[model samples]
Target: MKKKDKSHSHSHLAFDHVSFSYKHSDKFTSVFDNINLTIHEKEFVTILGPSGAGKSTFFRLASGLEQPESGHIRLRDKEERHRLGKIGYMPQQDLLLPWRTVLENGLLPLEIKGMNKKEAREKVLHHMKKFGLLGTEDHYPHQLSGGMRQRVSFLRAILGGNEILLLDEPFSALDSMTRYMMQEWLLEQWHEWDKTIIFITHDVEEAIFLSDRVLMLTHPPIKGEIDEVNVPISRPRNEEHRSDAAFMKLKQDLLKKMRSKERSL
Candidate 1:
């Protein structure tokens, strides 16, 4: 995250009584009713739940990929169905162009936005160095490790110039060690960029370790619901934080919520 001046102030992002369901669905829906949440400026929030808890649906609503049946989404002073381009989205897969080099992949978003090659390369180099992908800029995606490829994907997302990031299980595919390393890098970048991030994960531990707050969702089509757990650990959280009492307590609470859903089903 880029450092801002001492006096810089920004409005917190919010979801105000938002509700949604698929367009052709009947009463059976993916999500609906008063789903309210708020993320303070530069805050890191995690959305956690078992599969089918409507996590993806909620993200779609937040990303303006889908519209809510009713209610408003307020970002600062703006409202009224805005497609927030300021948000960077990274889905489960990296979604890199196979033929593109690391640098080219990082600059993909800029290219699509009509930036010239020179301008795009400048932004790409900036993120490459910031993200520790400097020497591999000329390598192809397949030539990099899983973790590095994900890094390139993240660089591309950041190059989109979105301050708020919506990440949906972005590191889930990697091995445990790689996943841990990626999580560390993610927090480092989050601190450096100072961007507001909303990350979705099924991993309770990851949620506790990475977020200022964890929103635990109920089962499918969750509505008017949340178990908002605050993580009070200090910044730049690491493996040690995982064994702390607060971390265990939050993890247990989240597990209980997930187990409840399992039983109900």
Candidate 2:
């Protein structure tokens, strides 16, 4: 694990002593208990855990889809009361409107913001090539491959013009080769856009490949603290780095930890 860099001191998002729970059928189930977490600006952070470990719940809280029962969620060092629409979010599924063309889907956020149709189209068009959707403007969701659909979904998320994005297993549905290619493409986009990304995934290798830090939520109903490891590998990582000795060791360690946590549950 790498040491925290002093240069990256400023946190773009933070959860301060936050607690949350859900009520179902006269039963209240707790998810978080006084948890504190900090994500730095422009950082690539991944949350890894077993199923039912509250990973989705974490994202929901971060994106403001659900609020904490106690404590605070801070954006840019200030607590934000209404966080919905303030942060971009891409769920596991593409969630694209099948009836809308690629161009129209990508323009949804900007349009919702009340930007003029002509200006929104211009803005989305300017980014089509960057998002690898230049020629598919008129294509519908069904006409595009899984990878392309994800790109369109991502484009829509970013069009919201937020500095932070919450991506929930966005590439988990793609084939292995396509998933790898999309991972590389995502890094390029992250570099170009300079956005802080909080990604959730069950794949250990995926977490190691894309994140500066991997946060592990071992068991459900988390209390006070969470485990984390910083990826020591250098930036501009590629396929070659996956085979590096450190990468392999880290992967093994993370897998071991995950397995142990699962067994404990």
Candidate 3:
């Protein structure tokens, strides 16, 4: 469970009437017809949708890997169409280079920016120790467990010092036990760092456990179709919270919403 900052009066990130599309051959596929949403500062928000719901498209848009055909995305208070370097994004797989040791991989972003590699290592070492990855710096990705690899991946994403973190199904590839552990670890990091997080996942329980609010997105060619489900359970959420009466009720509601949304789609 993580403590949430409830003082943010306005959204640190926002999408206003945003519309995006993709082109394949001669066909244009709309991902978002008009998305309007806001995420408050230092809040942990998860976007939940079923399979093939254009979930990845939303992440691509937020990370500036792609752009909307119309409308705008705002960070803090400014419009930034090119959010490329402005966000920290972590894809599902660790994506660590097999040849690089964990330490080398952690230093990559700073190295690319012409930053002093030595300084970057020092900073990362401190965080590694804090993240329980202190002794693994010399290890290659293949040598570490799935959980460890994901931890290293998360460390890489955070090393860039972005205010917001965009995690795309970061724990999906892990075993159930590892996913649970990673979820707990992620909350610890979120609370400690106080960074705003936008996480995407299809798991109802995971969304309930990790987010301040879960945004329900409709099927692709999304057209102003979204729902915000509030997580009323108090922070920091815990194992006890999972089976509690209120939590179960919330989970059931989310399940219903998903099924209904699926039917509609």
Candidate with best lDDT: 2
Give the distance in Å from residue 237's predicted Cα in candidate 3 to where it truly belongs.
1.7
- Candidate 2 residue-wise lDDT, 1-265, digit = tens: 2333536568899999999999899998899999999999889999998788899899889989899999999998999978877899987677899999999999899988999989999999988987668999999999998878887897888889898999988887778987888788888778777878999999999999999999999776898868889898987878898899999999999999888877877
True-structure lDDT of candidate 3: 0.85
Candidate rank order under TM-score: 2, 3, 1
Model 1 C-alpha lDDT per residue in residues 7-118, reported as the tens digit of each score: 3556556778887767564555656578877777788889988777888787777778788778888776478476557568876577898898998788778987899999
TM-score of 3: 0.89
- Model 1 bad stretches (over 4 Å): 1-11, 24-28, 112-116, 129-149, 261-265
| Regions more than 4 Å wrong, model 3 | 1-8, 112-116, 129-136, 142-147
lDDT (0-100) at residue 259 of candidate 3? 89
How many backbone clashes does every candidate have? 4, 0, 1
List the candidates' TM-scores in order.
0.83, 0.90, 0.89
Candidate 2: where are CA atoms >4 Å away?
1-6, 126-136, 142-147
> What TM-score would you give candidate 1 relative to the actual structure?
0.83
Worst window of 10 by summed lDDT in candidate 2: 1-10
RMSD (Å) of each candidate, 1 decimal: 3.6, 3.0, 2.4
Candidate numbers, best lDDT first, in rank order: 2, 3, 1
| Least accurate 10 contiguous residues by lDDT in model 1 | 1-10
